[model samples]
Target: MICCLSSLSTCVANLELKVKKNIIFRSGSNDLFKPIAGFSILLLTAWSMQILSIRFSQLLFIFFVLFALWPVARKAWRKSLEGNIFSMETLMSFASLGALMINAVHEAAVVLWLFHIGESLEHYATQRARAGVSSLMAIMPETVMLLDDGILRAVPVSQLKPGDEIEIAPGGRLPADAILQDSMAAFDESALTGESLPVEYAKGQQIYAGSVIVDRVCRFIVTSEQGCNAIDRILKLIDEADAHKSPTERFIDVFSRTYTPIIALLSMMVMIIPPFFYDQPWDMWFYRGLAVMLIGCPCALVISVPAAITSGLAAAARRGILIKGGAALEKLAEIKVIAMDKTGTLTEGRPTVVCVITDKPDDEDRVLSLAAGVEEGSSHPLAQAIIRQARKRFNDYPIAGNRQALSGQGVKGDIDGRDVNVMAPTFAPPFAPDSILQGETERLQDAGLTVVVVALENVPLGIIALQDTLRVDAKKTIQALTAMNVDSLMLTGDNPRAAAAIAGQLGMKYQAGLLPRHKVEAVYLQQIAAPTAMVGDGINDAPALRAADIGIAMSGGTDVALETADVALTHDRLAGLPELLHLARRTRTIIGQNVTISIGLKIIFLLTSMLGVTGLWVAILADSGATVVVTFNALRLLRTEKTLPQMILKENS
Candidate 1:
């Protein structure tokens, strides 16, 4: 801005001398309208005259029309006047008014028309760039089905009141925050809670809005209303997110503010003093000053950052990602390490069978079958894995049981008039698992699998090993990050066996058995190594995410992750991570380039003005043009290729 003002002042001074000395070439100073502006007004006038259309090209003329013909021209009245006028506006306003003062109707019309055209183009470009984030409204569902007793009721999600009982059926999204009361319910909480697994809802476990129920029906007691709900609060943060100023943006603003006053004073001297000393005509010098002011307009400077931001956001949108603002984008660019959550972030959040061991030959099939029968009737990942593995080997097998899922340990049922139990050792420390299954246990454990104990009639049957496998892309994604020189680390609430299994597979660092707060320590440590990003789509991931230099929330299950993350992946995708990094780097580049271009142009132009050779019109074009160019360049982010959907509806605000 400072450079812009300086350039404008010098241009104005030199232009005045040129205008005064060349009165014969064009005595009618108003005729110096921009070429396109003049032609457009001519075309408009011809059309208007033919059809008896309204033709008040001047604002002052519009004022007269309001006074004489239309009593209610609020839009016209307000549009003709507003807040601070930009440098381009100043030049356009002056050129048109000076023309009108000299009775050059066409010149005045062309100048104003030209400015309007430029402003319109700039606005459209900006809107197009910002289209991705502006489309967030479509991602949310409208209704949250509530249940009164066992009977179901459909209601607007926004109208859900605290304590209202809501039913989240399979494939339905939870409408509001609630205490989950349905014990058999399994929620794909990545959207709200950030836990990737189909989170098993105990009798009193809490659930939040925007979570999807993957399997089994669950009922919740609504605990929060619209503004207080999970997703809504995050959306509000996006709405109120403050734009953090980059060094370039702040400097430009300050420069622009100071440069205007300095240049205006210089232009005044050029117009008045030259004529007194050199016998130049007053009208000629005055018109030259006006032309100089027009050149010094700073439209480009105004448009630069917004345009860049628009493009950056658009690019992210095309890849199914979202960043709330320029500041967020900037922060995302700085992440050197990423602390990932274990349960839902790295793994699919579903446990799968990795080992099976039995003392007797038939025991393998028999024990797994009994376990599957009870597990099939339950929602825990361990139970689901037992069923999933059983079906892969033995199909068409009949299962009979009156099942009850034991929250802390396992599921139990009466099968064939006999009691059966499938238990995780962590849940039942007193139940000594069979030593016969020890061989397979070490193999699976060594491979990072969880050993589940199965029993028939209170006697040890066998062990079915389960593990949440790393995402298919997890290894490659880590490799990509490593290649980019970004350190990768994991924070998991799982035991050391589970953490080592996953981390070993990916050749990355891991810390196991971390509680919610302990994960914060991991995030803090990574930040100490370098600027870090805590990447996880989990409710547990939120605090660490907030503490990190950047937070990235995977899109899919829990929105809590999104609320805290600097960047949100609208689509659950690991590929988007790399793409976002690419965009951040690109956005930074464009900002830097624009800043350099704006300053460089101003400096060169200012130098010319000091030599009394620069003109106002040139300064205006250069300043505004730089801004526009920067914006368009930034917008280039919308075209990046590469979108890989890993799948999740997790969130961050």
Candidate 2:
């Protein structure tokens, strides 16, 4: 025993030193490692001394137990003094000390060793998950090119303010959200929006921070100050979201807190009641009680929940799905209904002019130019579509003055000394002699086109029909969701006819003409049927997203939407939605399996200990074995690629 313990001690010491050095070099020195290492060595030394002679073995073994007990003793004592007597440390300290009282020194040593290993594993797993998120923060550039006094000096990003003009060379990242000063440039927005392809931005367009300039050198004026850009806010939101605890974790915490004292009391009863009631030998019953304590140690059950959750979180992060925490992942699995916004969520948010209907064929250019001039100052998707079509037809158009937006209606301005208004048909004033234009507008709306009625002082000019094209993968995504037995619905502020037309194409339900508040109400109504998830990519959907059981935001969504959502599809693809749901369901199933194994094994071992069928070594082995099984089972969640590929293949088929 002395030779074996000495070799183990030397091995442990060398291993500890190597691990400590690696940890310190990677994450700075941790204070807890030193004491654990010191006490571990002390326990080994005391055990070695005991093995030298039988005469001194008993006394030295007691000393060995005390040396090993010090750290747990201090922790349990401090927690007890602070009114936290029901902690796992308290349970462990009592259990190990009880083992020593029964003269099972080896069992006590093994118990403490296994407990320490479990703690280390839990801590390391958590740190690894956090490191995955911290890597995103590392992408931010420290300095940026500032065009100060036209000299173009390199300055720290922290010194940048809104309105500052910064020069970005090709292949450089944008340090802040800014308006483009150059005519046009292509950018790789994958870091921010998760869009794999390069996006082109015209002059005066707003580009966010973290976008890489992929084309020629460009200059832009900053719109957001330092520390307030999209990338900075994303990092902050991830930190906040990751801190939330899952339901399973919370239940385990409460269960463990209540479990320790009850088990300790049961061990005490086993020591006292059997000796008195059955006239059993006191030493025999006492040893059995100690074994019972070892068997009932809640180490396996306590560590199981977090191990599985952390593994699931890390796996999801690797796939570009940012589930806020284990709770969000669990909730995602329970979502039976998914309420989605129409624009940006199911379709490309960028609208294009699909048809230009004019009352007179020759006046097409005039009507388009007048509507485009009024919409030039507007940033709405439909407005941009008209402007794009106008630019394609005529390069130079009269500029509009006194431009103003009519909330939920359209834009109004003075173009060529005449009052021009561009709006939806419902928001347009009555036109008595325009039955032909009215008929055309109805026909376009019925075809799912968003018609913009152009009027010159209440006299209709023509109808410019625009439509937000459905995503190529939208039908496939809906079909996949259906195959998973999940219902899909579209909630939009567009006209009911248009909304129904798109929904019919996708073969899903829809609630149209919904304002922001109406969307929230719709989400709440859907939740009555089953657990619901709201997916969107705009500020208007933020409220509805918050109202649902789980909020999934697109990567290209607004910061408010992203911050409010519980899950983010970083790749900005609906294809990831079904994949995320599948992962969440698998994670829940794994957690259930882990909890069952941990608890079931402990119960079986506990019964055997009470019947005197198991001894100290067997009890220790059972406890440690259960922990190892649960941990490995949880780690299986990290290799979810096997399941994900099948899911993708099925979706493709």
Candidate 3:
């Protein structure tokens, strides 16, 4: 009988403990739902207090306040156990409980209610700022039209593998990076490139994923495996951006660690010192101290930097400028000198005729027409340049007959029963230094041009000077950078004359004949003078790009350069460089504004609370309201300048 009684008592005690644990967890879960429920009960208690007896009504009010305080207190306790005893929740928990101890039940209820409201607003602002990143997710198509054994079938994008042929319909986005197989089509690449115009692609050209098929149905051979497409790469960058915090954000984080605990200790001193030493009323002094704790919550100060950085990153991505993280963005704004590669960075990577000097000025067009005719069948770079130049001036070119490749010299053929030759300047001149034709040819060569001559029956007609032409936006980009007080320098492996010609045209300095190692050394030397950025578009530039303060690459550049760069201009436009710098500067400005707003409000409320001029309502506002304001201020980056999608939407609307 004794053993049976002891076993029954142990079982009952275990059951009671289990019930208590269940009750505690149930009340603590889903903080928002319970607080809302508790608020409704508090409202009912306030109304019933008018009719009920004083003692019963007082009990009801106290019970309602405790019910609302449970979640806040539980969160504070959990944080304390994790060694974060001075968090914002801890301050709020103590403040509300202090109000309850002082018989300010209504004030306590209002403070918690206001805290919840402020939290909801902060949540909404964060979600809205993230809306731009969410829109990028929608750019990828969930289903793809797979070409299986020449039969079209809809399949999940995840099942796609390299070398699989797929067909995309008009208005459909590509599911993966692919090569155009059969038909040429126009695609809207705004999602990837941020250009509002539709780019036309030829057969065999590579098209990135997320581009919308604008004109017609097209077949493509997938080149990327699942989860390795362009959009996937972008999403991965965003996911990793947080790990690279800016210096400002790191300082704020470190500052908050010591700041929170100091505030907690100071609040304690405020509660005890005045009542004991100054002989003030204990109740009033304690109330003022609770108000001080509420005012000292670092919610606003802690969130200020990251909120701006997150919004700035999303904004930059929308503009087709991929900055690795806040660290890179912050570095970009500090750049005073931008060292840029000449070929493919400031100029087109291919040669084009810049000047046409004919033996007789009137015969320039005639000379070019004959040269284009003779070089029609040649696949040489110089031959293609002549043909491209001729097409720009004359629509119909005279046909050549019996074309012969003059090994190492150039091409020769008969145009309209007359023999014409397009050969290197070494073979087509009068051979006299003083002769007009010879002098002109040497002058063109001295200007870094590849001088090729067109001859009729071995008599020099004219020389066509060719070199890689400057990009259309090169001058505009340089001018914008100059206006912003940033200097530009050209770094290239090309000969001195070629580098000088390009640098002269743009009014910038040049360092020519550099190997990859020399370029890296140049970047290092420039960094000593001021923060410098290196922009390049070739595999040889990868080393220098990695060595700069910030490495920027054109997306159309070699894979090595793109991967090594800290920032990539996806549209491969120089104009985007200035825009990126502007964004960075704006982000820094907003961060400063946010910090000032957050800390300034706290200082005001802290002083007012200690003087007993403000109570819990103003104290909570100083903390939570400041958080909402700074968050919304940081969100301004999303719309500071119109993004590609915003521009497109505005046009349609």
Candidate 4:
């Protein structure tokens, strides 16, 4: 079992030298004192064994065991006082002292040393799991350049409030989430969104905290209050992630609480029952009993799931996939079907004016102007598209008066005292089957363009066709999901023709003309066959997002959508879906491997120790070594991208 063991005295001597040189342990002298002292005692015991009498070496070994047990004994006694008597430290203390009582002095020393090394490895793994949050905290600048009345002054980031303007020097991190005031700015958002290259944001775009200003100096108006920026939210989520434990992690917690005490009781029984009833030698059975206690520490078993879960969460966050917790990450891997909303999830949510047809060629401009007038203040995607088109041809559109939205239809208002209505073709009055308006509506729909009828005094004026382009990676993402044996389904309120057009292009299933509630129903239907995940990025998608087994939202989505979804692709790229899935599946695999390693080793050593095949030193070495192995195995999730080449996010088009 001791395949390789470093010399404890040599390791401690090197550590002491480093401390004296003020290298890594300069600030950790107090922490170094215990290990240095414990190992030095073992060194002295070794030297005494070389020349001194056996009795003298035995006495020195006893002193070493007692000195090693001092720190562990304090912790064990505290927990025993708290009614948790079978804690890891408690078990190890009893096991090492039992070994000494049986005159296994050398085994006792090695057992405690290995136990401490295992604890240190566990501590290091935990710190490494949380390194993401710590590294992110380091990115925020303590001070920012505040701009006031054309004067720039250095001010603490904490002192900056909402609406305060600040200037960012090139290569400096943004202190808080703010809106860019310059015409355009280039920033290195790799620390945040994980894009390798610098991203360009235009004026009025909201730039998150921790983004490095990569180009020229620029100014911004702080939009986030202190501690509510992008980094703060991510940190808070990671902190709360432990509360939302995965089923595997939760089960391990409950199992360990009962399993530890039962193992302790069995170890005591092994020590007493054999010698008292079976007439076994007291020394032999006592040594085997101590071996049982050491083998049953449960350190590796307890840490198996969480170590992997924590590493998985940190890895996902590094790639701009903000999974809320282990529960969400676990569910993500179980997703057999992913139902995506068409508007924002699959296609670019922005629609553009493809063409405007009118009764007369000259009336095309007039009809567009009327439509734009009513949609001027509207935030609807189609309404904005009309406004954008009108702006290109005319200086301004005549303002519509008494504008109103027709539920499930479109908008109606008065334009220059004439009743103007722009509504979906189906909602508009029936047109002559062979009429130009009807023909144009059918032609647009066939081409996957959303057609709206423009009316003046309830008479058809023209039809405008608008279309939202599919995301560059939409087809590729769907293909990737298909290759993984996960099906994709598109749910949209668009007409059957448009939905068919989009779904056909992506080669996926589709459900058209779905309202928010209908989308929820669709999610339910998908769940009948397998676990379903809903991916969307709009207010309408919130209902389905909540109803689905897992909800994933793009970061560019509405606040409600972002809040409703369990996971957020902060980079706003569909390509991240495959990467997220790969990470989740890999995490589940690593967790399984860790659990198998932990439990398998314990079971094997538990049998061997009971038959007196392995002594206390080998038992503790196996248990502590398994703990370190599982931890380092879990840490491998940090490099998952290397295991699966395609799991890395491709540069967004």
Relative to the true structure, candidate 2 reaches a TM of 0.81
Each candidate structure's TM-score, on Cα atoms with residue i matched to residue i, is: 0.68, 0.81, 0.80, 0.86
lDDT, candidate 4, equals 0.84
Those runs of model 2 whose alpha carbons end farther than 4 Å from true positions after fitting are 1-64, 167-235, 238-243, 313-326, 358-366, 379-381, 400-440, 453-462, 471-473, 515-521, 537-543, 553-576, 638-653
* lDDT (10s digit) by residue, model 3, range 1-653: 34643553464455335433543233233432443444565557554765856665666567555655666777789999999888888889888888988998767877876776666556556666656665777768888889898799999999999999999889999989899986579999887666788988888888988999999989999998788887777778877886799999999988998998898888999899999999999999899999999989888888889889888888888778888988998888899999999999998786898878865689989999999999997888778888989988998989799999988788899988999988887666364344477777778777877788888987778888889889877877787788788999999998888899889888899999999999999999999999999999999999999999999999879999989999988767787887888889889999999999999998999999999999987898778889988999999998855634234334433
| Deviation (Å) of 514 in candidate 2 | 3.0
Candidate 3: segments with Cα more than 4 A from true spot: 1-68, 181-184, 353-440, 451-465, 640-653
Model 1 ranges off by over 4 Å? 1-39, 43-88, 95-114, 131-255, 269-288, 391-414, 417-419, 425-436, 609-616, 640-653
TM-score winner between 1 and 3, please give it.
Answer: 3
Error of 1 at 482 (Å): 2.2
Model 1 global lDDT (CA atoms, 0 to 1): 0.65
Backbone clash total, candidate 4: 0
> What's the CA error at residue 163 for candidate 1, in Å?
18
Can you rank all candidates by TM-score, best first?
A: 4, 2, 3, 1
Cα RMSDs of all predictions? 11.8, 5.1, 7.6, 5.5
Residue 94 local lDDT, model 1 = 52
**lDDT per residue (tens digit) for residues 459-490 in model 1:** 67788888887776677777777767778889
Best by lDDT: 4
